[model samples]
Target chain A: MLTLKQDHSTLIVLSVLADGPSYGYAISKAIAAKSDGHFKLTASGMYPLLTKLEKQGLVTTSWEEVKAEGADPDATGRRRKWYTLSPKGHKQLAKHIEANRQMQALLDAFVAPAVNDQNAHA
Target chain B: MKHTHGNTPKPKPPTSRDGIETWLDVLTSMLSLPSSQRTQVRDELEDHLRSRVDDLLVLGKSEAEAIRTAISELGETAQLARHISSASRTPKSFRRFAMNATFFVLAGSVLTASVSMMIPTHTNTTLPGATEAIVVETAEVTEPIRHRFNHEREPVVDVLQSIATAYGLSFRFSDGVRKSPFGKTILDTQLNTFKGEYTLKEAIDAFQARMYMTYGETVLAMTENELILMTLEEHKRMQIEIQAYQIPSWAESDDDQRNYGFSIEQLISTKHDLEYTTIQPVNGSLVVAAPPEVHAEIISMAAQLEAIGKSMQAQKTQQRIEQHAQMTRRIDRLRAEYEAAKSVYFAEREKANEFSNRIDELRSRRLFVRSNDELSKEQQEALQTQINNLGEQSKQQEITTDEAKARFERLQSILIDAESELILSDINDALPIEGMNDSKDEMRTVSIMGTANMRSGIYQLPEAGKLTLARFLMAADVQDPNGKVLLQRGGVSEPIGTVGDISSGTIDSIVLLPDDQVVITAAD
Candidate 1:
């Protein structure tokens, strides 16, 4: 129901990857499930960020072939790119988490006073 | 399955596959990434799309509906392509500007010092007393000076001396600059001698340009009312700096980029004899450690090489077009010659046949007259004489016919040779001839036929010098001790010698020219 900006998307993706190595689709699925289908990172946004992360050495990628169930053994099935959070990526995730906490605290400071004022008027 | 990137051909997109493949093909083709990366990206995306489609299908959706739903989820193809391109491509402007900035910084730092050293402290006044360090101020250094040669061909020393006399200034020359390799001093080098008026700097720069063009390297600088001349190499030794030069992209592939690097190195370092300089090719750019002037020279040389390469490529295409046209013309001429020879042969054969028929009629008349017994003895004798004369004419006609047939056969052989030459010429254009002499005369080839220790093929010759039979045999590694060798030149074949005799210096006078063939046969 909400479109995620790049910084938030990167934080979410890196946080999802912090748990374990996951491909684009699995990462997308995890984002949807964690947000309860509220946060959305489209394919266009996901891939370029992943590419930038890989370029920055924050993530490492390897490919594996995925075959359909009951497919012939000799066939070269579909390929999936697996991305893993590097040591740098873990450090980045910690920084983002701390920044998010500070931002949440700062916003509560402003919103809590506004809510109290509205309740008093009521 | 273990995925490998090797020589294996890339897998083709699956057949439509409910339009998934068609959509992927369109997206992949629009990608601006290099081939290997493009293929990897496509494979990765295909897996994601297929996984999404399968998930949709599992949710009780029809196949078509699932495919359509999955396709819509990928967002617009063009936007995705642009994002990937922007993310993947290295910032070219930043790279180019960085390289330029490095070179200019090095050059600017060096030239700043060199320029200050060249500034004059005082002004020039007296001609003869100028040798006592005539002081020319920096402002007066740009003042126009008159220099005129007394004669048409004046020595460089006299010309400079005349300029010194007219301006009341002194000139100094380094020992290397004064000494010419061909003569005692560069001062002895002749110049046409310009009569035009120019500022001191302009005059010296103009003279330096001329000297650099004619000779190899010369540098001139002015300091304190004195003109200083020295070799560019010596000037470069004063300051050494490392600068990165961006080789213009002549080709898109890595191999061609490396070749451009090599070509620039060969032109700048090797060809120009920049001995103490080090040139390294780094990521499609040349990093050179040399003097500031030498760096300037290298950049100039690289530009010239690129221009030359483009020019040579254009010339080669033109040569190929001309070669094809020439071959066609030669073949047409041969065909015409063959047709003319055939006509001559037929005419000779007809003349011979007529002579034979006339001789037969004469014999028939003689026989009839003898049978009549009523004819005079003189009449019978006349008939016999006519038959004998006609027999002689028929014999001559037969000889002429044989000559025409031989001529026709010779022309036929020539026509066949010409056609074969055309074929070989075409083959030469298609593929470079292997095992050829490393020669600048790439256009010339010699054919070796009729058996040899080596393969019978057209071989290229050296740019210059005779390709004698003995030398060719040795070069070809022909070791047939008892094989007779014949040299075929211009459709005429003559025995050069036995391979053993030729190799042993017994028969070494036979020289093979371009288009010449060497025929080998087992010794009788």
Candidate 2:
């Protein structure tokens, strides 16, 4: 699998949280699953990125209790910190995606002649 | 993992497992954020690692292999920490910059203070006169002239002449103006101009300011017919009047007074602007007229002289105070030594008096005997005259104890020899007793066989007494109570001498007592 550029790490984290509220592990798993294992987000890399995004007000977090199945009713169960995409995060993600699309269009234009030349040689 | 019933302990969650804890430790150490954020990052990383490990275990991997795989998928600790550290340090870098800037400002302030302290207070400049002229000219030349010129680095003199011609004014230089130092300075200066309208005075003033010169009216006249361009020294005249009381003491005498006025003029002459000066010293006052700039310099010189005088006076006072303190200390030391010497002198005098009194008592009881048959009548008379002379000598004042002791010893020996001659005569023909009373006289005596101890190698008698025959005989072999012989008269087996000659004109009697004591009996 090919690794994505480090600058795009923020965009990737924000995009994963755009679906709904998610914890750090879920966010990393979603990014890897959405990119089809091409851009695997590591736990170490994903958490600081989530913290940076939260500090920038692009995401908000709260602790949620996730209990095991058939556990005692009196027990509080395990606590997982959940991250949610903010309004600012939604706007930033849209702008970043639009910029990525524009860059891709420019790359395609630049690569199309090269591909045509290679096809003519073939 | 298998779970047991009732009493068995609950298994730990995947997040708290050993492999997850190890990975979190490495990540936490690498992250250089604030403690709260660092712990948050560690907790999030632990949760994510647990989820990955559980997912791998569900895919049929063993627990150990699943934990290892989950950890391997994360990026290198150093790279991840760097990214997080850079993100966290954005605000910190700004604070760091502010701190560095504040340090530089404080350091600059300290450096400026140190440099200002090292620099001298006095400043030499022609700015005061030039600045005054500039203000005046700038106000007068508010309506600019329509003169336009284009020149590429032309001589300042030509530029000034052109500006003068344009303004319909004549420019003139003094006789030695071009050859003087000021002329050399003006000649070296150059001016460049483009198309512009500028007043002649304003242009000249601007050019002069660069060379530290002032453009103003000459002392002789202020006319439009000839425009004069003189150095700053040729500008204005100033007069100073000094009162009679303010004159220094050295200016009192006629010759010194003349030299004093000359020296003031000489002080003003040191400057380049000494072409015109008038110093008149009248009986009660002094008046000076010179360039305005020279007035300031003279005032400064006067103040400096006053400061030097005050400093010298203060130094003299300090030296006098130190000398007085030193003299006072010396006088105190000498007084203490004199007091100590006086006490010692009085104590020695008192001891000498005690010895004198004892000698006088001993001489009173002593008797001298002589045989007239052993000597002719004339010889006897001569001996009697000598004894009388010695008695008279002993009566005089200022006699020391040692002198009195020698006289007593002489009298005793003379009496002893005379008595020996008398004893050899026919059974003693009337022993003449001169000092003895008509009635029986009392005598105080002490045995020298055992009495007091020796003091400074001389035995002191136990009792005060006159030297009778019994006392003299007992003192022949003197000793202390301890049986230590203090003085043995003439040595062992020596014949005991008589208490002789009390008849030689009543010579002072000699006395012997215990413990080396001796007495001289003087006649009343």
Candidate 3:
């Protein structure tokens, strides 16, 4: 499994919210499910990253009352904190994706030579 | 329904719930965010943990097992606290520097505007000696001379004289220029060292800036004297026209007019080279030849005096308005009091009239009772007289309601007593007079008896012609007199069973007269 970079987490969070508004648990679940259990997101890492993104005006948060499917009408099921990508967050995510594509191309050249050396030894 | 009765165990409180709460409390206390922000963070974390526990519970784990797994997935509290604290810390010093710079710029703008308003603008008015035709022919210097000298605590005029001596120029003061008030003020000024190297014109400009004086080069042609130093005000004279109303009115006396004129002359003489001259002979208008600065000063003084006059007129008008307001307030108060008193008097008069009408009604009832067949003519006449007197007293306006009530009570008592007396007189008339015919002797024994009880006997005297009373002896037992008995002639009642016992030789005789009258005689 590849270790996610510090700025990669913020980009991933923003990209997930760019689709629609999502809460902390839903955003973490989506990242894990999309990466096929390879990238595990923790609450400790995601909450502070969300707080920093909110302070930098890259994302915004709001509290929503979400009731469970079978909950009683008067019951308060849960308080979910929802985050959405700001216009500034959309611009920053696009810039980060473009940079990652160039970095991937640069790494591809080095990886091709290393694989050929392994193939010769085999 | 099946009924099962047995000892049921109480449900235990959730241990993992307590553990999550304790962890949140510790984490929030460790973070340095504001309390409101810290509460938001705690709520968010708790919600996340509960959601995880709910997901685990759907997998058929016990509540305790689900809570433990949720907390372990959330990660350690200390690491989360450190990350949140670092993220939320503000850069205080940078914000403070920006605030201070903003304040300094605002203050500097205000100070610059104020200083620009205070400095006066300079005007290019030609001086008297600025014409080259009036310039003195002294030794012309091909190059400018620069002097570098320092003098500590020297008088300003002495410093200027030393500068003139170094330039080989003779300097003298114009007439009255040195002795003027402005000259006296500048002469007393002690200047510190003004050390610099400058040309002659530059040095003189600096010296004039400090002393507020200028050099007169035309004195060589005009006064045939050396270079003259006079105040800047003496060099520029202008004629100012004054209207008649601008001159303050003088008092009635001629001495007052002369004193005022002398004061104007003295003020002009002390401050400027000018004289007060009348412009129009009849209207009290005048013209003064003075420098523009001195003319401005005089105009300012006139404005101050006019302002004082207007202020005094306004004060007088205000005092009159205040006095009128005070009188109006007093009149309003008195009018209100009179209205209140009038209402009270009307109420009292209404009550008195009510009582008077009641008394009149009661008197009419009494008159009807007196007119009945039971009352005798004399008793009716007496009762009518009493009612008339009460009516006369009650008709007077000053008679209060209580006095009328008291008079009604008295009339009632008098009528009751008169009725009783008339009934008693009727009973007395029915009594027998049997022993009166047997008593013809001057010393005859007589027996007096009556059905009504009496304690004393009443007799009429023969010669003196008056009724007299005689007490009954102790042996004479009379019953209680329940009814009244009237004794005629004296019209008095005496108890029955009273008789005369003669024991002295002075013969006292008793005679029974006709018509039931008994007469007693005493020897003279």
Global lDDT of each model?
0.62, 0.48, 0.49
Clashing pairs in 3: B454-B495, B454-B496, B455-B495, B455-B496, B456-B495
Candidate 2: residue A89 lDDT (0-100):
89
Top candidate on TM-score is 1
Against the native chain B, each candidate's TM-score is 0.32, 0.28, 0.25
Every candidate's CA RMSD: 28.7, 42.8, 46.7
How much is B278 displaced in model 3, in angstroms?
99
Residue runs of model 3 more than 4 Å from their true location after superposition: A1-3, A68-72, A75-77, B1-18, B93-524
Score residue B226 of candidate 1 by CA lDDT.
48
Model 2 regions more than 4 Å off: A1-3, A70-77, B1-17, B78-82, B85-90, B93-524
Candidate 1 vs candidate 3: the lDDT winner is 1
Ten residues in sequence with the least summed lDDT for candidate 3 chain B: B103-112
TM-score of chain A, every prediction, order shown: 0.94, 0.91, 0.85
Q: Please write out the lDDT profile of model 2 over residues A1-122, one tens digit for every residue.
A: 23456557777777777777787666655665565545555544565567678778998788755554455667765556788889998999999999989999999999999999999999
lDDT string, candidate 3, B282-316, tens digits: 22323344333344445455556656966775675
Q: Candidate 3: global Cα-lDDT?
A: 0.49
Tell me the tens digit of each residue's lDDT in model 1 across B394-448.
8998998999999899989987777666554544443221122222324777777
The segments of candidate 1 whose C-alpha lies over 4 angstroms from its true place after superposition are A1-3, B1-17, B93-524
- In the range B24-75, model 2's lDDT, one tens digit per residue, is 5545544545568677666666666667666664554445556666666664
* Clash count list over all predictions: 6, 12, 5
TM-score attained by chain A of model 2: 0.91
